[model samples]
Target: MTQTIAIDNSQKLQLAPLDIPNRLLLGPGPSNAHPAVLEAMNTPPVGHLDPAFLGLMDEIQSLLRYTWQTQNQLTIAVSGTGTAAMEATIANSVEPGDVVLIGVAGYFGNRLVDMAGRYGADVRTITKPWGQVFSLSELRTALETHRPAILALVHAETSTGARQPIDGVGDLCREFGCLLLLDTVTSLGGVPIFLDTWGVDLAYSCSQKGLGCPPGASPFTMSQRAVEKLQQRKTKVANWYLDMNLLGKYWGSDRIYHHTAPINLYYALREALRLLAQEGIENSWQRHQKNVEYLWAGLEDIGLKLHVQQEFRLPTLTTVCIPDGVDGKAIAKILLNDYNIEVGGGLGELAGKVWRVGLMGFNSRTESVDRLLEVLPQVLSK
Candidate 1:
């Protein structure tokens, strides 16, 4: 038996009103959410399997196809962040003791090796120093020598804001009888992730970065050949929840229950993708490119140097070297507390040496860039 609280006593319970200041998000991820996305999240909840909700799911998949520039039938949103999608891709791709070749450029590539290793893959990496990219010859040599089951790479290295060129990698992987898995978490909507055109076998992205949505959902797509590899796995996938085969059944024609889908989050991402569709992927990509250039110009004018090489720098995110005699974290702290502008610190080997600045999706605009440029110097002085 439970006792009910008296109305008089309940009235005396002090509750501080929630206070959240408006902030300009220009960090590595979790960029400012579009108003449409927030409104969609406020919509009344519906059952995941409801006829209306199922239609929404179908639309989400279609919109993801547009965003990813692919016609793949297996595209769907995983109920987690970017790493979850990465883990799911690796977990589903190779079974125990399978050999895999990973290109290690920055932090995310190393993560792919770990994810594959967890599934008992014998991981070998063709390594490049931080803030650098591997030459095609080096990658090809490794691929030919290892002849592994999969070639894993991070399309955008968030740690150093370096973008890897994959123009010939997919063809090379195919020639070497290997599958290509790519991490596009920070690159997807902000740049071109031409999955079908590039012949990529597997790709994954997160909602927080380029999608301008909250971080709960991760969108992933796998080619038919990649699906075949999963089907032929001798052992069941180690991760039950992220097992793509069973997930396909639920997300496929059957619509069977594997787990309770986060209905509200799906609503949020669906509306986010709807906005992206309206904007058109190519236009959105161009907008990101333009804004990032503007940001680079301002940073250069202010005497800040870019860490990544000009040819490999990521358009959505820029890693800037901290000026001599200035404290990176201190400047970021001042900007956040005093100006309500949030930026990011570096990660892994780049930490304390650079600042990762993001111009992604809804936050990629002239006003946002201008405001940051205007205030950054002032914050740095103090």
Candidate 2:
């Protein structure tokens, strides 16, 4: 059932087949997807509400719970990128004029401030320099001063390449009678995240970073307390598209239609989560750490300095300071054009001063690390 269009004789159309280069993705996100994941995406599309699709939906939720290490009944994948889930978290829980305190150590933390403000939250912030994270005592002091209704933090700050410690932040939020929300966009499958144990009331992550899938669907979860907050909201959620109250019904037993779910992306995510489960989550974390150690040592041997301290550095992403008299953008360009390797440049305050390298999910391997170290020297010399 293809339709033919009439075109004028003077009109010239340029159309061709699409082709992309084979690249080693060592960037901040959208890492190299697994072979199985790609194949899964090619499966024939099914109606979003079909019985077979509904069964797959159930399985996806189950695997997401396992991947996130939580028993939250509200765990499901949103139909957009990581930022969509972030908005859902804020929109649902933050009514008009609610005080929200956000920790700003990097770009994504700054993003929380903007998103919450759009939802009519009275946003307050405590900030440190780009490569540093706040201490539990500092957080406690902020809570005592502002006493916000919500306290949000980024678990792994992708822009600065720092992993914020969450061992006691959740307990402190509880003591202060505040709900905890976390952004795990770069840490979900690459690191250890215990939503229930860490008392994370709400959390969200992307598919492309640690899940080894294309960037489309996002993982989201809410604790019972967060659900209760939603239940008691005085005002309607500002954003209609990202309202979790409606999303919950669509993902829950009601099976009500909110929107057309991204069926193929969900298929890919299911396979990727299956791969993680097969490898064992703990094993995956250790693998990322080991690979990052190799990369760090290699970078140092080649006279490059890491931007963040070793203890707080994120294993999934690393920020390397640009050497004196070297062009950071040139390095990334040459790597892509000449070596067919892709890496990320700095962001926000660290722009032009550092390069962001990622070793996430399927891309975190000894061979990938060794390959980058092997060619980086040659590229730098020329």
Candidate 3:
């Protein structure tokens, strides 16, 4: 005879069904997933190893290659957000005592420095003032000085709305016999990128920012050079879960299990990539640029000044200077509370000095720009 377990009545719970405010996301990230992507996410989840799920995984890989314009065999989506992908890049590539050089001009740049150091890299950095980019000559000089095993740079500096030029940096890495890593979190789907042409050995990005998907899965890729470094590492990868050595088999032909994949988030990411491919990556880039430029014009019309040099501004995100005597937090708060619109405040060196406005992914539209402009002036007068 089996005894029935009593239902515990000690725990209090609210019986109300879930509800959340629907605000227009115009901030740094998660700028509104496309409706179709959300619909895909709502589909019932399948077993991680099911044949149908496996087929979808293959499609995601192929679509990622097309989106990044690289034929990297190891491209796969990590089960967490963009930070997981960033950690994966460092874990797979940095061996103990390897000298890793990073370019630091903003928050994400510093994040890479911290991550590389945590993985036992003897990290070195070449930094510029926030809102500036490194010149090829400066990078070459740093490469000569550090002589690191890996050189990492941020393609899109999200904190300061600056675009670091990648054209010749990869060539410098090749000449110095070092692997090139890049943080493309804010630029992947909405900005122009050619990983093969750029010679980036390792790169990672998120699904939320530029792919028009809800945050969860992240895109990561490694080239042959990085793979070779992994193969030659004398020490085991510091991060077991993110180690590409095991993940490769799971994502590759072997189909071995590593961890239980987040089935629904992958569904959303797959759909996001599908829509991006359908739109053509170049066209999507153009859309982000067009909308952001319109936003800039509107902001300037209202007596706002942008923080970054116009030439270095990112098309996906912009840093608008907060006018003198205006409380940046109050403005952002009023916009959210009254207008039901959201804008981001600064981070790191940019804090309290500027407003972080994003025109990324599905939210990069003329309507989005118009709506924000219409509501912003009303809030500012308060």
Best by lDDT: 3
Question: Lowest-scoring 10 consecutive residues by lDDT in candidate 3?
Answer: 6-15
**Top TM-score hit:** 3
Which residue pairs clash in candidate 3? Answer: none
For model 1, the run of ten residues with the poorest summed lDDT: 5-14
lDDT of candidate 3 over 100-200, digit per residue (tens):
99999999999999888888899999999899999999999999999999999999998999999899888899999999999999999999999999999
Mind giving the per-residue lDDT tens digits that candidate 1 earns over 2-114?
A: 77965567558787999998999999988988888988988889987888888888998899988988888999999888888888898899889889999998888888888
- Using all chains and alpha carbons, the TM-scores for the candidates as numbered come to 0.96, 0.97, 0.97
Report how far residue 130 has shifted in candidate 2, in Å: 0.4
lDDT order, best first, reads 3, 2, 1
* Model 1 alpha-carbon miss at residue 327, Å: 0.7
Stretches of model 3 off by over 4 angstroms after superposition = 1-11
List RMSD in Å for every model shown: 2.8, 2.3, 1.5
lDDT of 2 by residue, 47-83 (tens): 9999888888888899999999999999999899999
Reference-based TM-score, model 2: 0.97
